[model samples]
Target chain A: MKMAILVIAMLVFANQTLFEQLKEKCELSKNEYLIVIFQTPGNCVKCFIEPMDLVELIKKNSLGINYKLMALVSVEREIELKVFQKENDWKHYMLVDDGNARKDLGAKGIAMMIILDSRGKIMAEFLPNQYDKNIEKAKKFVKSR
Target chain B: MKIILITFVTLTLISSNCTMKTQHILEYKPEKLQTQNLNKINIEPKGIIEIEEDENNIIQQITSVAIIGESNTLALINGKDLLFYDNTTGKFIKKIEATFEMTDLVAKSGRKPYIDSNYERRKVEVPYISTTNYTQNGIDGEIAQQFIKNFFMSLKNINNTFYSFGTIYCYYIGSSEKSIDNIPVLFVLNDELNIESYVVMDLNKNSHAIAYDFYINNYIYLSAPGMYKVPAFGGEFDSYPTAAKYDLEGNFIKSVSHMTNNYLLKGGLKNGWVYPRFIEVNNHIMIVYPEELAVFGENKKLFDLQNLPFKNDSGFVYYQDYLRYCRSKEMRPDIDVIARLFPIKIIDAFENENKFYPIILVWDKNKPMGFYYLIQEYTSDGKLLREVALDDEPENQIRQFAFNKYDKELVLFKKSKTSWTAEKWSLR
Candidate 1:
């Protein structure tokens, strides 16, 4: 009975280790060319263009580059993202860090973009600017990589 | 038994820690407005001006009309013409041809007019005219008349473009494709249809398309949406609402980023919320939300919370009075309850005489629900004042409510689904 209990404990430990490994592997790190996207709850006519344009630009210029897009939104705004994705046919991974993202990223201003490298280093930060011009710069950066 | 006892004690302590303690203070409730025979009050239905007959006409299909002032005059744009209206008489006063269709108009009073006619005329210097013969003066006369005619036309255009001299100043922003870039040029027009000054508010290119001036304490608060960025979770864009303060001369005072701890829980930041309505009460600006209240106190510190005594669903924060009114949503099924199961819709707020209260109206299913009961709770201490219900209508919904300070009465505009005509009830 003691041997059986030991075996059960070993299995649980193995499962936990495997789960942690999976989480680490799947989760985005500070290093991997991370692009932080700040969005309001609804599809604002002009404000909604930044993310949609960025995704399209990235997809068009995806030349052997690894990048992850993260969304910082409110708790009340989750359903809006789903609707936006479904409507736009967007197939990008999303994270749900609402208020914390704003606090951590210092992104009190919406439509602000921050690009981080694989080393979790912020390489480029774009505050409120023309959407097309900023996206063009982001495209050039991705292309250079 | 010991384990169970310990578990219960632990649970109780955890629950107690989670609950926040709030102070409650008592205040007088205003007497309920008499509901005796609301039908007895004589109310004349204000005629609706059919701006256009075509279904495809944009201005005719106005989903909402936000009345900015109490004056009998209203400046309305139908995507084609800038229309002036006499509100009381429901008469179309005058139509001014605008260079571009504008969605909004801001009025500034007591602005001086400045005109520069030289800027209007582009004259080519006439070479020295040495007339040797006196018989060929007919051609010279025609040439001089033509020059004078062209000069006068140019002056007229300039006068129409930048001439203003009056107590009231109305500025209009014309539609332009260049709106995607710099701040749109605003043309100030006087009461006499003359253009005043073209004020260019040097707005950042990243600012949202819509902007408005909130007048408070002899100051104007200009609110604009900042840029949009992709969210961490991917997909849609998030918006940040940013604001700036400007003096009467259009001098930039300061730019403030309005940040809130509450954001979307799922993937992206809340980006699209714009047009924050400011309410000033006793030297305090109450940035009110349907659920939360952000009080810019006298100390200049911003206080925000959702811990008021009233339910979140039934309450609305009146920005002007710094009063939060909580009313029941009787008819709207889509409207969430106090727990925020749905979005809160505040129907109207009206005041009569010394007693000021906002009327809570909502739509449930096909029927309209009216929460005539009003309450005001302050944030400093949970001081509460319960006001009496003015009227009750289980079937008929109150579509609009207006308060006339001159008459010291609360006007309730009711719309019945059964009847074609709407009824108005005045509480004196």
Candidate 2:
């Protein structure tokens, strides 16, 4: 009886660890905001925003904002995401979603940025720009909090 | 280090499944090979016009032949150059050059010219009109020139122009620099080579530059793949093979989404890959692709292999690997069985009292000579009323053949393997 109880306890602990691993890998936490960057699959060069711009924006504010950047890579392409990350120096997480990602996020064009709050509710969206206008709005929201 | 390892694991998991799916679709084995017997006919040789031999030892040839016009006038195009054969025997004619590189030619029978201003504003720095005057038997050239001019101008006024009972139009997507500002312009040119109208299609979303192709009846199809931002091993984000349709005046008629919900709902949206070959058959507009067929109608199918009957050809199976490899290398395969298999290669169509007949010329891969099997009045039930074997000799190949509606005869254009001269044939 004691041995069976011990095995059951270990199994439950293992399951908990697996759940934690998934949450860590996906960075899915109530405190973190999920920013989805949507794009069309091919011949969409101009729609893409430089990763450096995003990184600079995040670093400059010192607002203690927690967020994750996800790139919705289309399935049609045989893209190597690691190679993409290394070459572009994209330090954020990326996800592979095909056309569904566009429909789900209500994104009609490429290089669209949507900000989801900690509760997974959409807070705001930004189009193709330097985010000068968006940055001020985000600062106000952070200050209000 | 742990984060890097996690990223590596995630990428490997994602990429492996994609590779597997792609391979599964492309790597199917063929059952067997089949051959069909074709007819052969010899065309009389005319004098050589030009010839050049490639390293592969294959000869490139061009020729001009005379047609029995009112005064021995013939129409022919040689290696992108248009020439006319006007003589006593209707044998040899002089070369006629036009201002623009001729994309297509339509002969207007006894039609007069008319002008329109709708085309004037959209005309770029290039000349809006390109025409020439030619006449036989010492007839005045002024009448012919005016007739051609008025025909093009009047055609510009027609909202929908039909060519040989089929509507035709051209659509253009402006350059990337202009598209970003929502000023992307699309030009619609009708069958009579007149600018029908223009429209500015805006990319409402933050999009990559606009890239598109046209469907029959003026459908502007757009395909922008999402992989552009991702830094991958490939050179650039090649355009996807997605499509949509527009009206003659560049109005967005309908947009086609590439995805559908299945039981598992597993697949992603399709991308536009190649220039779409649009054809109107049985009043149905069908867009042909190597892997998929897009039929416009109530019953829509997705990635359905059975809809593409030409894929069953054994010759296609034989060349499948080489073609796929060439496609991977960004090269076009020479023998496109899909395009050639369908009746799309039919050069001309004519209607009799009770039936519509299509004159089709098909390529036979097994034959040593590049002969084309000419079928007169080819029925959809696979019946050939008249079979003419064209280009039997190994030294000569039939480049193109068409029915001269004006002359009421079959016109065969033949070129020699070693010479530039092309021979003309008229079968009564």
Candidate 3:
């Protein structure tokens, strides 16, 4: 009984550590599977299309998992932000981030995605200039989990 | 110095003798070897060399060249002047002065005059009751017009043949008002650079005709788009894209013609026009809608894309991915809708043997670096064999090319820095 309790406590502590790390970097608190897409003002339009599609696909499938999705946009102007929102149809979860967020997040370029665990721990990240490859990687990551 | 000169002279004598035909050179060689050791003697034979004098200097002002007929005679164009040269010897032959004016034929096939606000054809008064503000600019319109008259324009070449056609614009002084007419004339030249015929095509007055190709059966393919609703005196006609088959002499062949059967207009959209050129493969005449679609044969069947991995889906995926990545990029929504339906533009297509080589351009959906072409090879049954990306630059211009059917050789004529080069390659 003591051994079993010790193993469970260790697992919980590891999960908490992962959650803390993800929260520190992504500001995601839902402690579930979260996909945060980073977009820059000068990013290619082709970059954001796949993430939007993945969001739609996940929603349609009703995957029984805690998922928090948000787009970190560099543009500050409300009108410009709305235009970007309207263009991408990002009505639900959109966060305005500092322009240096891409550099801070270690993102190679725009259209980069950071996948986080339920405990706010980084699971996997995909950074392909091509959105097709990025979406394929995201789909495969979800399937593997 | 004398001994060295003698040795040089002896070597020249030996080389000249060896270069002669076997019958002429036999006299200089002994019938049998006098020495027993044949290994000690080294025999060298100078091979036959055919020399062709370079004629590029003479044709410095030449604009284009077309290798015609079985003899491969070159038909060179310099403005309104057409010069002929022997393809192998590079010898200049003769130059012919030509004029492209279709005015006489267009006036003869006249239409009804304009009346009221409606576009109804009605008889109008030939003479005006009063004349005022009459102004004349030299012989034609102005000095600018005179300079424009001398400008030369060449249209697409007839497929697999050296023949090409051009439109001739002519103006006539009517009883009351002046009128302009467009006439299409065919230039048929043979192997000797002799002008076989300069026949004016007997087509409709309001319709514009573009000659696509002249086939083996003497059938000429022409794109006469939106010709059914003929225009009246520079009036805009709704495009009803259509291609027709005519004889070598440009007479409409109803039996095999795509125009008579409504092949070009069969596409659901009425305004979806096609480029003038057509490729003949596997006995079928094929025309590409360039990145959008390809239609061929008498039935106008769509070429199957069974071999392409993603096929149509790949194009949409690219657009969606591109549009999402660049948040600031702006594009008309209608273009997105069209792209969702049809994603590619077929740029240039050629045929080698039974295989088809299509060059396609896929847009990046954003400005700056907008487009790139994908050169692909496919079988007649539409099996994709190979694909490569061709980056486009402003300086590198692909002017013209010819393909050898038997050897599978492609000779691409590229123009750069006011000079042209013929590059030959074998298709893998």
Candidate 4:
């Protein structure tokens, strides 16, 4: 089930029209790397406030300018997501998924970030507990390429 | 020199004396929510049992576990699958072939699993899956969908039989205009993991659903929170924090009125739903409030820890902080706001020798290490028996745990890179 979702997500993004839509939605594009973040509810107190924390990190250039960002937020409650988005003022485009995107991407109940290349190939996947570890290597790889 | 000589003489006399009263002066129970009288019980870590997993059974995580004394097999739930292991040694036996699909009904993400209406007939193919919602049902509210015989929601053990507490949303499935009726039932399972018998515990409040269930010696106590306005249907909010009592066979015995919340129109403010972490201790219902522990005796008024000399100041506290905390995980744990400033939850309980103990994961804000977590054991009489420190590695060293009464061993499910392992620690 997870592989099928991944293949379908990859195929959708891999397509030219959908890729163009993605670029237009975020109003940004590049040939380097795209960072897709999967947000889930009910893990820790950290998970609930993650969007604002993440935005703070990006504003301080903590993530470095190696990739464009997209958020695949689990739409457990649409109103709650809207409140988070409004309060955090996240500039990146967020795709509201009522589907099992978090479960399929293996985020389960934690926040996950996957760095994908232009061809929809996963370059680096940073999981929960420690989302900062090995993130610099991915940023370096993206910048070097 | 004089004091030393007196001590020497006392020690000599004490050593010479044989008759001594070693039991029951009735240790004092605390009167307030002030942190006090907690003793640290030390236990050495036993060796880790690497639960071998293969291509077939890839255990990503575990949520709940039980030690089936009669069968001599330990049971665990990961997602929807129930895995069994040897009780003595934590060895993977087999993942039962009991995954049922709930097709006809739409996959409602957060609805209670009332679909277990087909449970009595053993119709394995009907009721669905999903363990997303956490209610007053407490920590054991995991693996709540359809497994073997629709066995889920509050998997508790009384002696040898496995009892599961669940809500049966019984309306006219035979076609009713009004919404479904709320009927909470307790299903007892046999040694072979079959639903032997069940009792329909009617709390008489059909409009309100039960939050948590605690089956003490003679009766079952449940926290039934009042109703809140639903967004989908746009309904009325009529909820009260009620501690109800029932018999083992699901009969409504009585109820104890609790101090209402000062927050919103209803319910205590906390993460993972209402009915603050509660337990039955000393024949009194111990309700974990924000800044207080409300205890109620049978057919008595709600009071604090010390008998009837207790007071409840719950009406002034607003529940919006908790509701906000549930939605936005911002941490501003003010004293009278979120008592459970951290993740306060009852992990699981165990019976050792002849006493009942509930294990709770609590946090100490002033703990030196920034975020100090320890597993606290509370005696049946509502005393903080002892606590053991959990390894603070940050990424989640211990996710879930189950205690085996006979062996007096605690099985901790720790996740490695890809596989899962069990660490056995004897807390005797």
The TM-scores that each candidate's chain B achieves against the reference are 0.45, 0.39, 0.55, 0.58
CA deviation > 4 Å runs, candidate 3:
A1-145, B1-161, B172-175, B205-207, B212-216, B227-239, B253-273, B305-343, B362-373, B385-395, B404-407
Residue lDDT tens for model 1, B341-391: 212233333322232243333222223342343323233322223433334
Cα lDDT tens digits, model 4, B1-428, are 99999999999876444112111111112133445545665655776766766545555445456676567776665433456777656677765432222211112322232333333432222222222322421212322331112223355555766665543432122221212333455656667776566566544422243634455457776665433322210122323434566677656565543433332333333332344434444444555543333333442324433221122333223334344443343223343233332224344545564444545444444444333345555555545566666654544366677766656677677764554667777776
lDDT of 4 by residue, A1-145 (tens): 9999999988877564534554566655455566677654323334534433443454355345555777766544334354335323567677655555544443433336665666555566554555466445444544455
Q: Write the per-residue lDDT of candidate 2 for residues A28-125, one digit (tens) a residue.
A: 88787766665433212345543334534654663777766676554332243433443235666665554455445544333366666655456665
Candidate with better TM-score, 2 vs 4: 4
How do the predictions measure up, each by TM-score? 0.38, 0.33, 0.44, 0.50
lDDT of 2 by residue, B1-428 (tens): 99999999999987787557445434533332343443332233333333232232222222222233333344443322234444224334343232221211211111111122333423232111212322322323443221221101001111233111111111121221111111223334443333355343422221221332233343444432221222211323322223445454434444342222220021222223232223343444444333222222211342221111123343323334444444554433434433343322444333222223444444444446432554443232324444444435555555544333334445455555234333344443
Scored against the native two-chain complex, candidate 4 gets a DockQ of: 0.04
Q: Kindly report the docking quality category of candidate 1.
A: incorrect
Docking class of 4: incorrect
Ranking by lDDT: 4, 3, 2, 1
lDDT of 1 by residue, A66-138 (tens): 7676654443323434543532344665544444454454333333566666544556655454666777777
Residue A28 shift from truth in candidate 2, angstroms = 65
